[model samples]
Target: MGKALIAGVMRWQNTLDLTMSPGNVVAKPLEHVIAANDANKFIAYNNIPPDIPKIKTKSNSKANKNKC
Candidate 1:
């Protein structure tokens, strides 16, 4: 009975090791490469001119004009 218990414990340990092994970890660099490629494609397809001027306005101008 003791020998059977030891064998069962060893088998369970092996199973745990297999399930938690680092060799089963996913490759992160491959994911980064895929993300960068996707970003490049997205930027290429959605290109907008960079020289456009942005509108800037003061918020209190309307209240000051109303008081005048």
Candidate 2:
């Protein structure tokens, strides 16, 4: 999966004579490669919600709970 992504970026860079910058090559063409591979269909099937779940505790919280 990762190799395909890098290959896609390199192909795009070569075709357009652009430098190897992430911003220019990563998002858009990676999206195209994903779509072309039908990954979006699987993603749609999962239907994951667009919210980050809040962590109930942090490292400091664990230390407090341990209470020496």
Candidate topping lDDT: 2
Give the Cα-based TM-score of candidate 1 against the true structure: 0.14
TM-score of each: 0.14, 0.17
Q: Please give the distance, in angstroms, between residue 27's alpha carbon in candidate 1 and its true position after superposition.
A: 2.4
Clash totals for all candidate models: 0, 0
Model 2's C-alpha root-mean-square deviation from the true structure amounts to 11.0
- Per-candidate local distance difference test: 0.36, 0.42
Can you give the lDDT of residue 41 in candidate 1? 29
Candidate 1, poorest ten consecutive residues by summed lDDT? 41-50
- Candidate 1 ranges beyond 4 A from true positions: 1-26, 36-68
Q: Candidate 1, 1: how far from true, in Å?
A: 45
Question: After aligning candidate 2 to the native by TM-score, how far in Å is the CA of 17 from where it should be?
Answer: 18
